[model samples]
Target: MKKVLVTGASGQLGKCFQKIASEYPEMELRNFNSSELDITDQNRLQQIFSEENPEYCINCAAYTNVEKAEDDEETAFKINAEAVKNLAEVCKNTGTVLIHISTDYVFDGKATNAYRETDVVNPINVYGASKLKGEEYIRQILDQHFIFRTSWLYSEFGHNFFNTILKKAEEGATLNITTSQTGTPTNANDLADFILQLIREENSEFGLYHYSNLGEATWYDFAKAILEFSGKIDQVTLNKSGYYKTRAERPTYSVLDKQKLQETFKKLVLHWRDSLEDLIINRFRKI
Candidate 1:
């Protein structure tokens, strides 16, 4: 059986992988949360790599707090950039294929058409810049790596827009979300399944690839869908400013073009709404 080591086990994406791990019984997966293994600690990473010697290392760990990243650029870079560099370096030496999770924020969000994998990156905020730096490190230091740039990730097990919207609707609280900001809402399960596909095939098409649900929606549309899908209707208003203000400026458009991924993986990417419905009904409702 193939051995895979997953970092950031407690994260939404990592948990999603854990949820469906049983389906892939041919692989032995060792999932580790931050507590079990801090990516920032190079010595610990080296120790683990030396001990486990996994054939594949899926790095789901990253600093994802966009708003907080503005104030804590150092910590964000440490986890997002420096830690990723550490992992890439270790993976290079150990001959382990490194699959790193990145974000669409790496792009400036200025493109009218969907951003492609080859699009020039210009991160507008600290979070995006940091993630881009991590990507650079992986590309510069390692050849055996898969960097998946995803956006608007949500899952049942973690704190995400999906659960937040459902909770707000249940409480009958009026909510205001940004209408200008647009991106694809990725169900982590879809991404998890795709990741497993690459590993199962021992896919060595190593490079940066964009992966997200098909189609696009604004934040408001996302909220509306969440409410409707959960069978709840609350006053979910669109707010252009004020209450929705953050320290960093968000990209007006960040829908990724998944042509490269879809073609390479030989899979059809589902529409965002369709995937959202499936997740809410089959997974979220059960919980």
Candidate 2:
């Protein structure tokens, strides 16, 4: 049986991957959250890799606090950049295939069209810059690797836009979201499934690929959709407010062009609205 090591096992995407693993009986899955494995601790990570000798390493761990990253630049770089470099180096040495998650923040969001994998990266904030650096390190060190750059991720297991808005709506609090910024809202489960599919196929044609649920919307639109889906549309007051400001600069538009992924995989993710509805029915309805 092939063994797979999943880092950041407690995160939304990590948990989603864990659920996906149940369907594959031939694969042995070992999961590690930050408490179990700190990617920044080089010696510990080296020890684990030597003992476990995983055939594949899925790096889902990251410092993803976009606003906080401005103040915590060092920590952000440590996890998002340096730790990634460490993983890539170790994976390369051990001849292990690496699957690293990245973000759309790598792009400047100036382009009117969707961002392709080949597009020039000009990150406008610390978080984006750090993630981009991680991508560069992986590409340089690991010969067998896949860097999946996704955007606006949400899931049932962790802190995300959907749950946040739903909680606020339940509390009868009005929500003001930015309408200017636009991007595709990706479900973590979909991405996890895609990763497993890639692994099942053992795709050696490794490179950067963009994966996100189909369709695009602004934060304001996303909020409204969530409220409506949660049956809290009446309790929620949707307002377009530029009043909220953060230390980190965000992209006005960061939707990715997934043509390459479609061409390669011969399939595309489900429409965002369809997936959103399914998630609400599956997750929120049970609550």
Candidate 3:
């Protein structure tokens, strides 16, 4: 069986991988939380790579706090950029393929059309710049890499936009979520499934890819969907993001073009609303 190593194993995306890993029997999967394996530490990564020699490494570890990253760029860069460089070095030496997760923030959010892999990147925030740096390291350091740039991922396994909205609904609170920023809300489970498909098929058509639920919506639209799904529409009044202040400068539009990934994988995609409904009603049952 092929061995796969998952870094940031305790995070939401990593846990999503763990939740469905059992159904596959052709691969032996091992995950490590930040406590067990800090990606920033090159020595620890070297030791792990020397021992496991994983055939595939899924890097789920990242500093994702968009606003918090503004105040602490050092920690963000360490985890998102320098750490990625270290991991890429090990993966290159060990002959392990790296699957690194990235974000839509790589684009400055001023585009009128969906962003393709070839689109020029201009990160306006620290988180975005840092993630872009990680991608650069992978490209420069390792050729065997698949960099997935996804947007607004949510799952039942961890803290995310969906959960936050659900909590607000439960408390009968009105929310003024951002209507200014627009992007797809991806289901983490769907993303995990796609990753496994790549592994199962051993697909080699690799580089940068965009995989997000089809259709675009602002944060306000997202909030409304969550409230509607939970039958709590009466509890919240969604408003434009301009009413609410955020520390980081978010892109006004950052939806990604999935044509490359869809055509390559020969896979059907889900709409943001459909995936959101499934998660709320089905509680993230495998889909």
TM-score of each: 0.96, 0.97, 0.96
User: What lDDT score goes with residue 273 in model 2?
Assistant: 83
Please give the RMSD to the true structure for each candidate, in Å.
1.7, 1.3, 2.0
lDDT of 2 by residue, 133-153 (tens): 999999988889999999999
Please name the candidate that would achieve the greatest TM-score relative to the true structure.
2
For model 2, the run of ten residues with the poorest summed lDDT: 278-287
Output the TM-score of candidate 2.
Answer: 0.97
lDDT string for model 3 (256-280, tens) is 9999998888987899898889878
| Model 1 RMSD vs true structure | 1.7
What tens-digit string does per-residue lDDT give for candidate 1 at 1-287? 98999999999889988989999998989999999999999999999989999999999998989999999999999999999999999999999999999999988888999999999999999999999999999999999999999999998877899899887876778787778788999999999999998899988888989999999998888888888887776445434332366899788899999999988889878999999999878855654
What is the alpha-carbon lDDT for the whole of candidate 1?
Answer: 0.90
Task: Give the poorly placed runs of model 2, Cα more than 4 Å off.
Answer: 285-287
For model 3, what is the alpha-carbon lDDT of residue 128? 100
